[model samples]
Target: MASDQPRIDFSGGAVGYRFRRSGERGHPLVRAAGIKRDHMPSIVDATAGLGRDAFLLASAGAMVTLIERSTEVHALLKDALARAAMESPELAEVVGRMTLVHGDARYLLPELKPDVVIVDPMHPPRRNTALVKKEMRQLSSIVGADEDAAELMRIALATARERVVLKWPLRAAPLLEAPKPSHQYAGKTVRYEVFVTALKPHVK
Candidate 1:
């Protein structure tokens, strides 16, 4: 089923299922990104794998920019977004909030200057363990282990106006090279680690 593998479909399937549960509040990514009824910070998903988190942020009312370096992944996101926009007015509204960019985020981050930057760069799959997730398999086949995660985090912190969020697996060690996150929002299997890089958070 590799060819028939689940792609990023906002209309239906796992990505769609999660999108349905996304609200303006309550979700950990929502909290970590400081998404509220009145304050939906502009966010940049530095590693826009499949565009799922970026879509969720848009659903919660934030203007999100997604940067994907991989051309194939970017194409998948673009096609899914186009198809989803035609599904309904509600879906269109959310899709409209997301802007997709294809390039290396390290260079693009400075120009975007978002209120928040979210980094979920790929990690080398755990040693000696199988990558059982289809998406991980696809990602590994495409991008391999992201050796520059620390560098990306450093750039994100420098570029973001308010803060940077790192999406990581629960129980994994934090990146030692980057400044420790100011705090973290943990879920059942993953966490959003927030690093407050801005001394004064941008407020409207």
Candidate 2:
């Protein structure tokens, strides 16, 4: 029998997840990269932590797919999305455009062909524990770090048809430097590295 805990959904406004003004500036790297709300490629948010970036991408018109391995986080995100769907018409549309999958990104990403695969793995929280936001702490606790992010990037590069976008802090080194990026967005502390790759050819 499953635990009798009340599950949280990230579909609607169930978790109070909102795309307020600050969210536009949520990740400096994304904004600095000139990633507009209207120009987005088919995206697979592999790390779908809290689904913020995924929601933003969908709102920006990208066909976004989110993958989460944690049942608790997935349930919370689903509930929040469901609640947001009922309350905000615009958010509802964005949520409608998103597809959530409960599984590991490595195994699942290879099966699909997306223009861009977006990865934002969980990193260390600020040392001032009190200063850390509630959601940030919650996310850290749930997702932890993808110590094998290098491998994830390798698989993402193999799967993506066009490019793989890696969102990381400016201080950290690029993921293995495997796929040399054609472009980069350097923000205050975070950066978005776009690793371009040719789409697989079809042999008709």
TM-scores across all candidates?
0.89, 0.77
In terms of lDDT, the poorest run of 10 residues in model 1 is 123-132
lDDT of 2: 0.71
Candidate of highest lDDT: 1
- Candidate 1: count the clashes: 0
lDDT of 2 by residue, 35-150 (tens): 56575567889988778677767755667899999888888778777887897787788788999999999999988778788888876444333423565666666677788788
lDDT of 1 by residue, 1-204 (tens): 447333777868665776676544578988999887888788999999878788888988899999989888888889899999999898899999999999999999999899999999775454333423766777667766788888989999988988999998877788755577899999776789999977654543
Q: Could you tell me the C-alpha RMSD of candidate 1 in Å?
A: 3.2
